[model samples]
Target: MTELLERCPVCGKTDLREKLQVQDRSVSQETFTIVQCQACEFQFTNPRPDAASIGRYYESAAYVSHNSGAQGLINQVYKVARFFTVRRKVSLITKLNGGKQGRLLDYGCGTGHFLAGAKKAGWQVTGLEPNDLARADATTRVGQPIEEPSALGTLAPGSFDIITLWHVLEHVHTLNETLDQLIRALKPGGKLLIAVPNVESLDAQHYRQDWAAYDVPRHLYHFSPASMRQLLSRHGLAVRQKLPLALDAYYVSMLSEKHRSPERAGGPLTVLRAGYSSNRYAAQHDGQYSSVLYVAERGA
Candidate 1:
């Protein structure tokens, strides 16, 4: 079953324009339409799979986040990238929190890598993962019990010092509801670190419909810097900083190339060229990274 939204989920605007159509390359291979809100410029997959049926789309062994043991060239590369990035993520959180360890929550913490890293850095960590397999894997990795998404509502208000969502926000079904809970759970001056793919990046523009970041049905919403600001502002949370995940372009470019027809696919050299170009472009233009990490804080 699928649900067709009548209004923009971010702003409740009824005016939406068709942006483009992309296929579910990972699972169903069914084509889905991407629509943009005329007012907010937020893009989303229209008539996406409903909450009850959406789990099927994520059941593939290739879904690296859920299938921690997934093996393949791409999955292996993703694991390697994660290995280096986790330390940086922990360092960033530590720096953001005045070099002190505090209570942290990793939302949608796939396989608990970040949670494990943060725990090693002396932060009390809680992980929330919806996928049962991923949650189990995370529990083993972090050596602690991982909670389900439903646990967010049960948390005491203003309890966490920092909360993070790494490439997870776009996959959320209840955007506003989830944000509300996260906000309510954050202590005053707490930070929300959200990393999401930038739909406005040079690579996304170059690939157009073939952009791998636009993983349809699974990534229900596509966010640009502008749209992200507007969405966060609605909850009285403002972006404090925007940092680029420089390594993402290369990985995303690799997938984007594979998404193109075999005859049109460009291999390693093409992937490197595309990744370098996107990063260079973003260096010259503010808020144009392939993937942006938004550090947000609640208003006074």
Candidate 2:
């Protein structure tokens, strides 16, 4: 067991209760305990691994690029369909915010998939990624090197019309500082979009320690809807809209269950059936939910 340094990232509250203990899903040797902040109701990994130590797990070739390998014909077709679905969703977001043309930044842009899509949609897109290989791929895909967020001081305050962190906020080491920087980067009335795992979901309850979305030291913080709203409000932002995210839950649950009991596989079909049913249930009602997207605007 790794002993954690004292302090809660969000509220600075030291009072914590042990929530769960589980083996690290990505790395076999590592184990972590989840703790809940008594003060803020925030669930996080105590004694979380520092950035350098955690980088090793992501060094694998599988972690380097989004296009890991060529898929089968059926998988390729499905991917094409999903691409359109994502494009349509981005279109809806643009429409909701009154148009897509503006300066946009995608924080933690893994392999630049969404950034590329946003660029195609007419936004002047920039990306921020800490992973070297992932950053390199993103730069290649976007035709420009993704800038480090720290180097973004060159941009005028409020320069961005839109800033997004897709499943990235929980991974930030300095959550408050990151949000401060983002708030500074956004133009007045600009939109900030954040997506993260929702601890309030039913999947969290059922899986407990085995929940893949918790993601241990890599995912330092787990946000409930209420906690997320509070965090945003504290940083001079207001939530304009929120929607439950589907799709991720299914894949994450599948991965989690597989990791939990690797030898107990009935067959691929059985695994697929379980994931499908769990995903469908979560989609229909808010059980073991995986992600939530928040759209917020800078406060006046």
lDDT of 2 at 298: 91
TM-score of each: 0.99, 0.86
Best model per lDDT: 1
TM-score, structure 2 vs. true:
0.86
lDDT per residue for candidate 2 within 1-300, as digits (tens), equals 334747776677799998888677665447888888889888888877776576665544333234434355434543664577558656755775586477888888877877888788887888988876677878888888797656655667988888888788988877888888889989888889898998877667667777778877778888988788888888878998877666665555565675666575344565466556656666777444567889999965
Best by TM-score, which number? 1
Judge candidate 2 against the unseen true structure and give its global Cα lDDT, from 0 to 1. 0.74
Per-residue lDDT over 1-300 for candidate 1, one digit per residue giving the tens place of the 0 to 100 score: 999999998889999999999998998899999999998889999989999999988989989999888999999999999999999999999999899999999999999999999999899999999999999999999999999999999999999999999999999999999999999999999999999999999999999999999998899999999989999999999899999999999999999999999899998999999999999999999959999999999754
Instruction: Show where candidate 1 strays beyond 4 Å.
Output: none
What is the number of backbone collisions in each predicted candidate, taken in the order shown? 0, 4
lDDT of 2 at 98: 81
Q: Please report how far candidate 1 places residue 36 from its true position, in Å.
A: 0.7
- Show pairs that collide, candidate 1: none
